[model samples]
Target chain A: MKFEIIDYKDTRSGFGEGLLELGAENPKVVALIADLTGSLKMDAFAKKYPDRFFQVGIAEANMMGMAAGLTIGGYIPFTGTFANFSTARVYDQIRQSIAYSRKNVKICASHAGITLGEDGATHQTLEDIGLMKLLPRMTVINPCDFNQTKQATKAIAKHKGPVYLRFGRPKVPNFCPPDCEFTIGKAIQMTEGKDVTIFATGHLVYPALEAARILEKEGIQAEVINIHTIKPLDADAVINSVKKTSCVVTAEEHSIYGGLGDSIAQLLSRELPTPIEYIAVNDVFGQSGKPDKLMKHYGLDAPHIAEAAKKAIQRKA
Target chain B: MPEISELQAIASQVRRDIIRMVHGAQSGHPGGSLGCADLMTALYFEIMDHDAKTFDPDAINRDLFILSNGHISPALYSSLARNEYFPVSELATFRKIHSRLQGHPATKEKLPGIRIATGSLGQGLSVSIGIAQAKKLNKDEKIVFCLMGDGELEEGQVWEAAMYAGANNVDNLVALVDYNKKQIDGSIDDVLPLGDLRKKFEAFGWSVTEMNGNDMHEVVSHLKQVKSQTHKGQAQIILMHTEMGMGVDFMMGTHHWHGVPPNDEQAEAALAQLEETLGDY
Candidate 1:
């Protein structure tokens, strides 16, 4: 693996742009926003398709229920809000109207993870992925970068069931292959190595890629896999990659308690009991600070992932 | 207005269906079903103007009715079937395995009259608002009607929806609260006091109305008067007062029959008191 200093872009911008495109391409694609329409980068969609856009005015629960009903009359509804307001604030609404009834809805959340910055613990929702993944029919996607997030937004609309697409505010590097195809449950192997397998999602995927570059300098072979779809996990890809590497490091922007790491651990524990280590927020809420400082405090930075990978490799050996 | 004798006959048949269906399946919320028998009968027999025989599930030109308090599915199912939405014989399959007459109202099993799945409280009003908004957007003249439980209003989401409906002036919607006073746990006042429902609706910018939900004549007259209240830049809220279990002698006064199945003897006794006005399934 080789290190490359890449240009960065915010994934939220990707989601907003994609939403506008969906609105243009399909008249049925209607959007609903809470007060964070500008923050979620949904202003473009809201401006261009004003009739199709609904300003829900800080009422996420009403937005969710209305989205469910909008689907009844054949509208492909996309609900935009902060990750916290989209999930935790309206878990029952999403559970009963959307997931339980299996409505065709896209719940696009922005400002996920510690990268949300300044707004603090209340806004930084690391537990959203865990809460959404527990839903039976929800397709949870925490894409790695701008391109991947945009691809996911389009992909989820074509998908018939409920989807939870999470993206962050920070301007991370746009490093994925520009024209790469995106299949919802398929894991993309960003870099391949032999010593350890690193499975990461959301903002952590970029960090894992960084750690892979750092490890290569030390002659430590690391295989980086982006577990984009958290719910219908790319199990075969994970297991196959883990078998080659013989050790695993699972990373995510969510809590270590019940997010991607937990799902991967559950999978490896049952079939292939590999030495697995995690890089995620521990049982604690984040506070107002720079995104980098918050990520470090939560133990979810590239250095933390690099250390976790080394630990897993040593444990496996 | 529908004749009192005819309305009484429909309600009697609906009550008979409620008792038999609950007994046949050994499950369901008979208390609320019996409680809303007159309301359902009034709506189907006289209030909602629709051609029941031509059942278009999403007919844009026809009026839409939603049972937000979906636990009362037996009453709704009986009303729809008797109006010929489906074969009335399907009543025998209530709550049984592979039956379209699910414990709650559902559209999943291709149930003709059910527009959406409901059982989880506080969601139906929001859905009804969405439907009403759609009707307005489409310039459809038909009204959207939804029935909700007084207890179901305790859900915070319901209030959120109420706020949105009032703010947006969703005038095409008519929301009826079954103010039966009793809930599954106990009386709503003991569980959680709902202070002045009509005032709350009025504060929320709704045209509030109250009616004796058990009185067929009042139900019919109020429904007609409320239609004039529609498209007036405000939503309509009807606080309907009724007993929890209205038809059966033993079940009427208490919340005991809320979700309890009637035993064979209890079923027979209840049925004997109510005549087979439209014949049993």
Candidate 2:
């Protein structure tokens, strides 16, 4: 399989672009920020649609509750904040007002995982996927690249219910096709192979693709599938891909617990038993460093995924 | 509008319902419920222009009320029922398994009058501000009223929401505090004193109004005045004063009944003090 690299861009740009488009297309789309407009790339949307944009001024708890209230008046409110503050600091507010109440709130979080860099462990959130997916009626999406994130931003607006849209701050290789359409709860098959399956999400998808290329040179055809939507896991896609491969390796820039890997392992353990390897953080806090160095140190780069894929293949029955 | 005497008769029945409901559940907050009975009665029966039969969660053009301190759900449930939001007999199922009335006010069961879930304190004010802003965005011109316990003011998020509403000029909102001066452990002064609430709210850019919440006529007239003050470039908050347990004799003036329900003989004695004008459910 061949693909073209479009450019190097942060996935948050995709969110900003998609939000800007929504501002023009849908009159009811409102944007709320807790003082991180420039970082989240919500500046353009806030400027273009000033009336619909609300700056809550560093109060995340109030922002979450206000977002829940905005839905009561039939408005689609997208709240922007850092991943840590978005989930951990305001968990009760989200639980009572947004998730349990079943408010049509889109909780768009930026600077997810250690890729946020330099900000250290306090700013990075590796437990966000687990925290969000645990709540009933919550749809969690962690898009891979600029193109996919943009499409996902537009997709969640059309799909009603509570959604946690996770993205990052670093500029990675934006290889996904610009025209690719995003569908909620559907997995995107990047490359198909027959020996082993490499399931990846968020910033780790490009590395998984690279890992597949490395495995191909060693006479191993590793399949790479993008599991963007974590909750409502695409069971058919996982089962079908694993049936041919018979072994699995899940990769993500999140903690090993309650991330994409756990979701897949739980699925396969119940449906079709298979040996699995998780390429994620081993339940530890991240440190301040360069994003690429952090990825390498945490064993989240391409070479690590390739090695994990081989280990998974070796363990298959 | 109902006459003052008529509203008082409804309040008397609402007080009786509060006692009966708490006694039946044996596990609800009755002190605050009994204290806010008159205010709740005034809001549902006369103050709010709400359609109880055709209750819409959106509440579009109607006045919306949120019980922020949801532990006192007995009062809200009785008021909603007395206003015909649901069958009055349903109040018997409070805090039971497979019942719509959870320990707290929740929207999950699709209860007609509840727009959002509350029990976790300090969240309702923010939600009410959000609704008020939405009404402004939609040009609906409807008022949003939120009732909070004085003890509920200790949560930091309340002030966060207070600052936001004041800064954003969320003028269509009317926030009221059940200033019973008592909390579960002890009085609010002993726990965490909210020094000079009127000055605090005034400092936060709210036009403050003080009223006796237990009096039916005062509650009705003050709420009406607050309603007329909406869309006037500042949010309004009424610091309503009342006893911890206002209606009942033995229960008044203490925080012990804040969550304790009356027993069999105690319920009979409490019922004897209050006249059941509208007939008990």
Candidate 3:
């Protein structure tokens, strides 16, 4: 199936829209922001539901704990902040108060990966997915576009437990269907092929579809699948796809160590061993640059994914 | 409400449980557990309005307590079991493998009373503030209480939560500090002085009060006064001054018994000092 771009939008706007919808639908839904309401596009939710919204004012740790506390009274709290502060900054707070205690919190993080641009390495978070996925009860999700992020945001409210919903800063192509069903831990196959499978997540998913197009020109029919959920990964989808394709290329806007690539590698090594090449940041910190430049610099664009797919296909015996 | 004498008897028995639970486990914090025994007993037996039988995590319309300094799980577990949240027999399983009584208070094992996991300090105040806000949102006029150690104030997150609660007027929270003046390494002043706790909490916009945590009557009355003061514009905090180990003479006056379990002889001596009022769980 061919995927088309619907528009261009920042994924955080999708989260804000979804949160506003949740405020209308579920009275139990509350939002907490650590002083990044504008950046996270949470202004609408904050403005609409003043009573339910809490402006935590640059205290990420307090925001996480408060989110957990809100859950005890049957309130579903959605905390907003940069991906870095959301994960690494208040890791212990999330670990003890949320994940270990099994609090139903939606940790909605914006400005993920080097795509955060201009703000440099400190604001950018390339390790959030790894940090959150390591926690016992955390459900990690990196949605591809605006629509998918909005859908994922609404979906996780119904999901009981801690969730890390990661989204990007730049105005990437909003290609995901607005009405498409977004089941957590379910993979969406964008295209079909028999030679190799290109698995991607977050901002890199659109590039994976582009990579499939690039590979198709070279007589390489690449199957592109969007693995939105990192933890509790869609193993059945992954196994079934690799069984047909035999070779795999995993792509993400994160470090190759603990991101989607590592998750896929662990799964394949245990269940179905296959030749795989990773298209991700190679264990290095990001720098200040444009989102497109960073994607190309870190070798995370379509051409790089296509090249990785070729390498994986060649390795298949 | 239980009489002040009855509360004192329960406190004495709770002290015994803290001592014996630590001795039975051979590994638990005894000093703080012993130090906060009266306050825990007073809250469970006389101060808070809670049901011991049906444990609900939401705790809607009921007073909730969070043990922030979770190292004193023995004290919390004993208070909980003695209050009939669980069978008093489970007190013996403190910190044992496959036991609901974890080394720190946790909701993981489905323990009846615990609503959250708290071992790492300075996080509980923020959690309590959150729950307090939730109660306000639900229009459930219940109060939320959080207990923290004096040394736990050193964590930056505590001050952060303090600032939020004070600024937001989370009026339904009563945070109690077990100001025993001792920690693992040494006295709180020697380790990391919490410099004028009342002034600091006041600066963060809290209404500060002080009480003798080891005095059962004082604990009961002071907590009752604090509860009455809730929803009157500011979050409440009680700087409860307590001895490191109140009943056990050898354990008192030092930080040595902060986390050390007593030997058989020491346990016998400690148990002999307090009468077994609640039948020695």
Which numbered prediction scores highest in DockQ against the true structure? 3
Clashing pairs in 1: none
* lDDT of prediction 3: 0.93
Which prediction has more favorable DockQ, 2 or 3? 3
Residue-level lDDT tens digits of model 3 in B131-198: 99999999999899999999999999999999999998899999999999888999888988888888
What is the C-alpha DockQ of each candidate?
0.53, 0.85, 0.92
Tens digit of per-residue lDDT, candidate 2, span B1-281? 68999999988898899899889988898899999989998988888888999988888888889899999898899899988899999999989888889989998579989889999999999999889888988999888989999999999999999999998889999999999999989988999999999999989998998999988878888888888888899999999998887889899978999999999999999999999898789
lDDT by residue for model 2 (A1-317), tens:
66567899999999999999999999999999999999999999999999899999999999999999999889999999999998999999999999989999999999999999999999999999999999999999999999999999999999889999999999999998898888999998999899999999999999999999999999999999999999889999999999999999999999999999999999999999999999999999999999999999999999999999999999987
RMSD of each: 2.5, 1.0, 0.8
Candidate order by TM-score, highest to lowest? 3, 2, 1
Every candidate's lDDT: 0.88, 0.93, 0.93
**A284-316 per-residue lDDT for model 1 (tens digits):** 898999988888888887888899989998897
Span of ten consecutive residues with least summed lDDT in model 2 chain A: A1-10
Error at B15, model 1, angstroms? 1.1
Candidate 1 reaches a DockQ of: 0.53
